[model samples]
Target: MGAIICAASLVTYTSVSAEEAYTLTIKDHRFEPAQLSIKAETPVTLIVKNLDASPEEFESKPLRIEKIIPANSEANFTIRALKAGRYKFVGEFHEDSAKGELIAE
Candidate 1:
């Protein structure tokens, strides 16, 4: 879990919000929570850790961010939610199965 915590801390480190930035993990072919509720319009950090030995891509069209998370590595990005919306994203390399979402509040 060293990588996961590192990814999360990378995200949290950039934040100055009282709401607190959160860490999201991707492992076992799934996004752990699969769904997330975050403070809307607040600058949020998403640290994506890919535990698999294969490269994975993370994307959220509604959130307008796409990142390539290397095998056993992580990617960090910032997003500001404006309102409640379901942002659907997935691994481009494994789009058929590696999928997930972001539920903003």
Candidate 2:
């Protein structure tokens, strides 16, 4: 009985520690919902979906993330818990149009 209880507790902890998820879509070299708001000091799972016919590289200097998302597909990224501030990101293929920021508060 104790072993079962311990196993259940572990499962609960695992779920609680899982990263929060958010989605961003790319179409016409632009990010939908260009500004994202998230909780500070919480790990995040960012799902970037590319709707265009060309691939795009998602780059964020502050987040230290640089990933290539293939055309008409989606990619997942794990972001560590962040401090309260804004982290900017851009699409390498279309920096002028594809720009976004993550605001953690």
Candidate 3:
């Protein structure tokens, strides 16, 4: 009985500690949502799905994150807790049109 209770507690803790998730779609050389809002000081999982035929490099200097998402493929990134501000990102392959920002508040 004690072991069962401990396992249950562990499960609850795991669920509570899980980070929030957000999805961003790339189509027609642009981001579906030009801006995304998130809670400051909270970790999150950002999933970038590329629907375009060419690969794109998700780069953000301020966030210090960069990843290459293959054509028609998706990639996942773990964004650590950040202060309240705006972090801009752009697709290196399509700098002219593919742009977005993460607003933490």
Candidate 4:
């Protein structure tokens, strides 16, 4: 019962965007929105949805975050924006074309 409740809660939370989530779509061998502008030091959730036919690994070094979102699936990660700069991320599955930048302000 507890497990089921927890699972349900998680599903509900992800399905409903409580706060402004920086949504990104993995398509066309690139990351849409190209650049993300966010407040510095605030923990923000990045909801990544891979709309392609293959999986994508949303990996960030400065943010120290990584998550694998299967094809036609969605995944998210939360990180506190640090110093103002450009943070780069790439998809592990398609390292060459799938790439993006997050600009913190």
Estimate candidate 2's alpha-carbon lDDT, on a 0 to 1 scale. 0.95
The TM-score obtained by model 4 is 0.76
lDDT of 2 by residue, 41-92 (tens): 9989999999999999999999999999999999999889999999999999
In model 2, how large is the Cα lDDT of residue 44? Answer: 93
Across 27-46, the per-residue lDDT of candidate 1 in tens digits comes to 77677677777777676777
- C-alpha RMSD of each candidate structure in angstroms: 10.1, 1.2, 1.1, 7.5
> What lDDT would each prediction earn against the true structure?
0.76, 0.95, 0.94, 0.82
Residues 1-105 of candidate 4: C-alpha lDDT, one tens digit per residue: 999999999999986645457888999657887788876766678888889988888898877878888889998787665688889888877889888888888
The C-alpha stretches of model 2 lying farther than 4 A from their native spots are: none
What lDDT score is found at residue 31 in candidate 4?
88
- Ranked by lDDT, the better of candidates 1 and 4 is 4
Better of 3 and 4 by TM-score: 3
Better-scoring candidate (lDDT), 1 or 3: 3
Ranking by lDDT: 2, 3, 4, 1
